[model samples]
Target: MKILVCVKRVIDYNVKVRVKADQSDVDLTNVKMALNPFCEIAVEEAVRLKEQGKADEVVVVSIGPKAVQEQLRTALALGADRAIQIETEAAPEALNTAKLLAKVVEQEQPGLVLMGKQSIDSDNNQTGQMLAALIGAPQATFAYSLELDAEQVVVTREVDGGLKTLALKLPAVVTTDLRLNEPRYVKLPDIMKAKKKPLAVETPDGLGVALKQHQTVLKVEAPGQRQAGIRVDSVDALLDKLKNEAKVI
Candidate 1:
């Protein structure tokens, strides 16, 4: 089976985010960029499926400016057979990104589609479901474990109360959770080999996906500094503070 995985470029999780001075958006000037951690997990899962002989090919794709190809190459290094970049000047919102991915899904027609539950930069967990909706495919989100057969895939997902399992037929979409699997570290040999892998670039217009703006960010701000905690002498003092100064009561 051919497995298609979606990856994303974002500020490295280790980097501290800084809001723009004008509060227009988060300041990205010269920030360190890396593949989204969850997306890396998706790529790792795809590669594992291939290694296990459950999949014939693993293809990775990303959406963004040319810079996104770096993350695509990273996926290739992680063992994807090929990479595709849906080139866009600015990062598109979730729905538009889903639309673009739907086009690719139509073209690639892979047996399975995989992606992260959410992108850390936006924390918008909408793309996978939206892509499934646009493509009319069965979807399982927040999958922590997956079992696959010729015709269907069984997914175990985490829920607030416990875990939920579902079986989805082929040509389905699955969003991976952190527990899916630990991603393997890329080796130097693999990194060198990834440079030789085929990397195709396509545009939204070429894919017939018209970009549309559905929401606007009025402003962006950093969270306010956390207040220091006060020590209470006893439970009564804590109760008094909660009932009065903190106004919990």
Candidate 2:
């Protein structure tokens, strides 16, 4: 089986965020970047399948600026066979991103496509599903575990209260969740090898997809600061405040 894992470059979760002075976007100067956390799980799972001899090849793909080649190289270090990058100055909206990926899917034609449930920077979980629609493939989102039979796939997904299962034929899309397998770090030897591995760059128009936007961000504001609560002298005072002042039972 051939597998294609869709990954993304995102701002490092640890870095402090600042809104641009013009209020158009986030300030990215001197900010750190990395792979999306959930996409890392998908990469790890693909590597495992390749190691088990269950998969023939695993390809990593991403859509972002040229700097994102580093993220794809990171996945190659972790064990993907090759990578392709769709170059853009900045990442676009979810629908446009999906349109870019659908072109890659059409070109590669891998039996399986794995991606993250959402990207931390945008927190938009629509790309994978939208790509599936564009490519005319079945989609299973929030997958925690994946299993394969002769020609079918069984995906276990995380739901609100419990787990749910879905079965799909080959050439399907699966989006990963947090409970997926823990990702492994790249060893020193693999890092050097990954540098020499194959990586191709193409533009969105070169891939024959016109980026389209379906949503807009009016503005981004800082979250409200939490206020400290008053301290009560005794249990009776607390109860009195809850019942009369705060109006809670």
Candidate 3:
């Protein structure tokens, strides 16, 4: 059976984010871009399934600008069989992205679908669940571990108190959590081989999916700077400041 892994291009986790001068959005010019960490974990899991002889193929897909192909290539270098790019100038919102992915799911008919529990850039954590609902498939989110059986897949997920396990039937959706698996390092030879692998590009219009904005951004602004703390001579002074200046007490 085939496994489809969805990935996203995001700002590297290490880079310090800067707000644009006009406060329209985060400044992305010359920013260091990388695959969403959660997406990498999802791709790694799909590749492992193929390596263990459980899956016949692992296909990686991303929805973004032409630049997203760079991330698709990275997924191929990590062991995905092929890549598909849904070319768009700007990233769509969570619901629209889910709709687009639903179209891909219908066309691919993979035995299982895997993606990040949330994209780091947006952190909406709704795409996978939304896609599951739209496609009428069972979904397991925040998956920490997975076991593939003949007709069903068991997933252990992180919950509020502890971990919970569920068995989902074939042709299901699973979103990877942070502890799912560590992504392997990309090798130089694999990078070269990925270049030769099949990479297809499709647009939302071609997929019959509309990229509509359900919400509007009123304004983007930097957070207020925190004030520095002042040292007090004794507990009395601290209490005085708290009662008078800070007014906590």
TM-score of every candidate: 0.93, 0.93, 0.92
Off by over 4 Å in 1: 230-249
131 Cα displacement, candidate 3 (Å): 0.5
Candidate 1 residue lDDT tens string, 1-249: 999999899999999999999999999999999999999999999999999999999999999999999999999999999999999998899999999999999999999999999999999999999999999999999998999878999999988888999999899999999999999999999999999999999999999988999999999999999999989999999999999999988
Model 1 vs. true fold: TM: 0.93
lDDT tens digits, residue span 79-159, model 3? 999999999998889888889999999999999999999988778999999999999999999999999855999999999
Query: Candidate 1: what lDDT?
Result: 0.95
The candidate that achieves the highest lDDT relative to the unseen native structure: 1
| Clash count list over all predictions | 0, 0, 0
* Predicted structure 1: clash tally: 0
Q: Which parts of model 2 have CA positions greater than 4 angstroms off?
A: 231-241
- Per-candidate Cα lDDT values, in order, are 0.95, 0.90, 0.94
Which candidate number has the best TM-score?
1
